[model samples]
Target chain A: MALGEVFLIPTVLQDDETALESLPINIINTVRNCQVIFTENERTTRRHLKKMDRNIVIDNFQWFTIGKIEDSILDTFSQQLQLGKNVAIVSEAGCPGIADPGQFLIAEAQKINAKIHPLVGPSSILLALMASGMNGQNFHFMGYLPVDTTERKNAIRKIESMSINDNCTFIFIETPYRNVPLVKDIISNTKPSTRLCIAANITAASENIRTKSIQDWKKEDLNYLHKQPTIFLLDGGRQYAPKSHY
Target chain B: MALGEVFLIPTVLQDDETALESLPINIINTVRNCQVIFTENERTTRRHLKKMDRNIVIDNFQWFTIGKIEDSILDTFSQQLQLGKNVAIVSEAGCPGIADPGQFLIAEAQKINAKIHPLVGPSSILLALMASGMNGQNFHFMGYLPVDTTERKNAIRKIESMSINDNCTFIFIETPYRNVPLVKDIISNTKPSTRLCIAANITAASENIRTKSIQDWKKEDLNYLHKQPTIFLLDGGRQYAPKSHY
Candidate 1:
């Protein structure tokens, strides 16, 4: 039998109605056609699927909650594929296999020569970079920062230096509650002239994305971003002159 | 007057009916509301906007073809924003400010503190990475490789080494015509076990995305990739065991 195809589906970054607008209409068809689903959070995935289509019978398909890529999970996944069952992997938010545990299943699927389809959707990382006005030609997405203060500060310094030397944009995210501390570390460790972009609550009514130099950012009250999902972008090179009169 | 908002609009990666399905419905409202448009190619942008909504009066908006970021263009862009006239930037394909010159305008927008909105749309780079089954937690997007053969080979080797050392997937694109030669160089310069993914004609009926080891890829003919838009991903570390029987 031919190997079953694997679909990498994307979900909304925010829980609001506007957040769902970011998803493509065709995602509904793909979701309905799948026989098995591997998701980061089963409850949230089921809710999102229902929101996408009211007619979908949630219990008709098999579901697996992805905690860790255990051997038993891979065994079931591979066996399903061999049985010619179309499988889908959904992340809590954004695209699968990106800063999520879905890549392990995708890697296994690739080994078995299963066709993989990645549907388009909202990605906070990609959206942040596009709006940052930084050099998009070369960029690095570092999943998260070190938890320790000193190590994170050192990481910030290294990232700033790399940006300066390579003319590349460095993108990193932090856990919601740690957003403020990370911003503080970024401001203190980097040069005053270096550019930093803070994108919070993306794809939602409260979305705020702004780019400013570290010196300028120091004057603002960033308490608003304390617990909001945020993406930080740093660019130490390619400074622009202040706006000139026409 | 309040600074006008700048919208970064994404266009279809492939010129096909199914490709348009990837775009969000909200984009239509944003496009219709804009008073000015900065696009990579005015002709293609007009055609795309027309396709998005046939009822749109294309000539109502002031159009600017972005050839280069000239001082004159920035002057006009700033003036419009200062006047509180919302403007939009559209690329020939995919998201603006990514592998395109839209960043220059965005940089100016940031300098002046204009609100920038990046709408959700198809992005080949993000899509290719999602399906490559490579490490996406940390990755570097190096826009394009060197055009010179020897330099290109050296570049490929460096990319592979970086992937192995950093455990990061490296993504880069080639001009359609150079796809075959770049693949040849990648296969010849990298280790047999190193994995490479070729994603060509993404989002089109002819879409092809596959990941395989260097040795395995060498046995197949790759001429079909010639003259097709393609994304190449290299992952030299993190090899998985061959699928085990249940």
Candidate 2:
């Protein structure tokens, strides 16, 4: 009973295995039957499924490339409506259509009357946002910025300038390998009085949820940066994570 | 041996009952000796415990009140923390310290360095926010707005004027009795093209999750206005939760 035929599943994997295994069974079936699996990293997804003992046949799933990703999504979304069925989109990690590369797909889905169902699960992004408690009122997810030193620095500078008290929040993520460098850039480049939180290896055994001032951070090196997967959340001068600085 | 002297139990009757039963065997007598329960709704909490068929005499149990709420919290936090003991704050209908009455206690606990643990459970606020799709990236929970028309209208106006985009989200609950008036005001006052989403009775039977453009909604009177326990999540804009002109 495939009420919806096409599906988009995220390819990124989280550090937790047991929780990942608890994905909705219907979603797993949809992912298995979909003719095309538009994924950021098809190889990695397949490897993860294999590790989870899910023997899914990936022969028919087309690995989505940047050039064809948009068209494939648009086509599937259109066809699903024509057939009167729903299409699901999954992100490489966390919930789909968020910071993942599926916004264009979701926006298109909305433009056409296609239903977009986002299932709630382990979202490191949301975890960091909720845990940060700095600007939960009105915030924005700017996604990941360019890794080029100058470009990244410029982007951080813009975010820094935009920070206002209790107005809005800006959330972004960084690659695990580049976490250290990104932290260094954030600590040095952002305003000294600004408060920031780093949620590392979120929902894992070694999770580190700490919000602190930029000035205090600059005085020391967070040794854990080099040892784990992490995400950085900064709100110019608002608040820290649950930990007390005093 | 008791890891910590004080126990922070949830408001759930099941939790209190289990604790009451477990202590009678005297194996967990340490838990019985340190039973100064710091509860928010003292009257209701005590009643729930009594209903659980427990005759446990609680001479030491300090059922806190709304007025004593502040003092009791500070004293409990300081005492438990200094003694290197953990005190459990019986959670209410949902997670503690997020847009609920227990926040002051949690904040004071944090200030004094007392360990605060939040267990996973039903949170109407988070549930409604997620179901609304009005942008969870940044959101503000102003509790329940005043029932008076002027104050309600003013609150609505303040939130309605916020920059509408996928960046900021404003969430506030309305009195079930005044839901219709609120909706009417929205239609007449805000932009006709703004988008508004109402999630009613979230996570309960007869749940309603619908987002309609103000222009589209003006055609009918929402009959469910009288339904209590409804949540209004408005993302100001012509696209998200919009204002309609009838």
Candidate 3:
């Protein structure tokens, strides 16, 4: 008997055709091949699946939430795999299991010796890195910084220093609402010479990616970026001269 | 007039429908809109673009090779953007500007304040992380480890320790031919309990992603994975119970 497999599916970051059109046709076929799914949110998962394939019967497959995969849920998930029922795991946005809650089930699937296939899709971190004009050979995705104001500032300084010392790019995200404060903290804490890349609303119509030095950014009016989903990148290696230097 | 923008285009990792299908349909439109393209390899970029749209006249657009972005080429790239000529940048494989040579051009675009759009596509690193079942929130991509035996072993040990100390996943890649030695080094140097995921031929026909403890992996025969492009992940957090623990 074939062991049930696990498929890691990536969903669109924004709800639009532009983002939707990025997905492969295989995604719909992969969805159809699965009998059970573990998703970050069932409602959004169904909506995305329907958008991919309106003909897909929403009620035919069993759905489970992966908010917090307790031991019991883990047991059932692994059991289903052992029973030869392929399962799909979808995150609320973007790719699952990266800065998301899909890793727990993936770990369980590995333990049970289930085949795992991670389909392709947009990853905001990767997208942000792609346009940052920073070091790509070596980089660190810090996920999110410490929320405490003092800790966050200290982290910014440390990250800046590390970026210089290692010649590595540092990427971090902020809560949408706290985006303004985070940017302010970055500007205040980092060196004036350090290069910063602000990538906001990635893959959206208003998507913007710009690189500037901390000092140059202080002179600009950037309040419009507040509350937008943004990814920050800092590369202190002077790989490329920032606008100020130019 | 709005300045011409830079689009960081992502290409297929493997030359197959499964790999090519992951790219967005908008890529063709993006290609049509661009008047100039800076690519790592001009021939391969032409092949990939032709694969996406055969009707795309390969000679219609000016091609620039980013083998070594001298000051002269950098000036030309930025000048083209400043003149309102949209340009596309394509890497040899996967997404450009991420572990590829496209960042220099992106940096030049940034210096000139050109809008940058990183379209969605398959990234082997992100794909590997998605399927690694390891700590994804805090991870470091070391890119490539040292080639020397002693330095490589020391690097592996340090990476393993860092994974344990920070509960972070450590990802690194190896040259295709050196894959076997790297795997041997990993199994011999890492702790018996440290979890390592070997993801090979991502988005290809023989794609495989599996995680196991050093002890468990030592018992298996995996010589077949040699000479294949692969991504290795090490996470010592024990985020979930290993197969032995289960």
Say which docking band candidate 2 falls in. incorrect
* After superposition, candidate 2 runs with Cα above 4 Å error: A1-13, A17-72, A78-88, A101-118, A129-195, A213-219, A226-246, B1-71, B81-91, B101-161, B165-169, B235-246
Best by lDDT: 1
**Per-prediction interface RMSD in Å:** 4.3, 10.2, 4.3
Candidate 3 clash pair list: none
| Candidate number with the higher DockQ (1 or 2) | 1
Q: Which lDDT tens digits does candidate 3 get at residues A162-184?
A: 99999999999988898888899
Please write out the lDDT profile of model 2 over residues B1-246, one tens digit for every residue.
223333323333123332222111211232245445565676665664555436756555655543344454566555655665555454444334444445445445434434333322334555455445455545556566667778777777777787364345566767678778778877776666566767665534345555666776798778767845677767674332212311
Error of 1 at B22 (Å): 1.1
- TM-score, chain B, model 3, is 0.95
The residue-by-residue lDDT of candidate 2 on A1-246, one tens digit each, is: 233433434332355654353243334554665555445556666676565445777565555532234455567656654565544455566555444445445445444444444333445554555445455444556557689999999988887777654445567777777888888888879888776777776645455555667887887767678757676767774443333321
Identify the runs in model 1 with alpha carbons over 4 angstroms from their true place. Answer: A240-246, B240-246
Using DockQ, rank the candidates from best to worst: 3, 1, 2
Candidate 1 on B1-246: residue-level lDDT in tens?
A: 788999999999999998898888889899888999999899999998899899999999999987766788889999999999999999999999887878888988988989899999998999999998898889999999999999999999999999999888999999999999899999999999999999998888778889999999999999999899999999998764434311
**Distance (Å) between predicted and true CA of B25, model 3?**
1.9
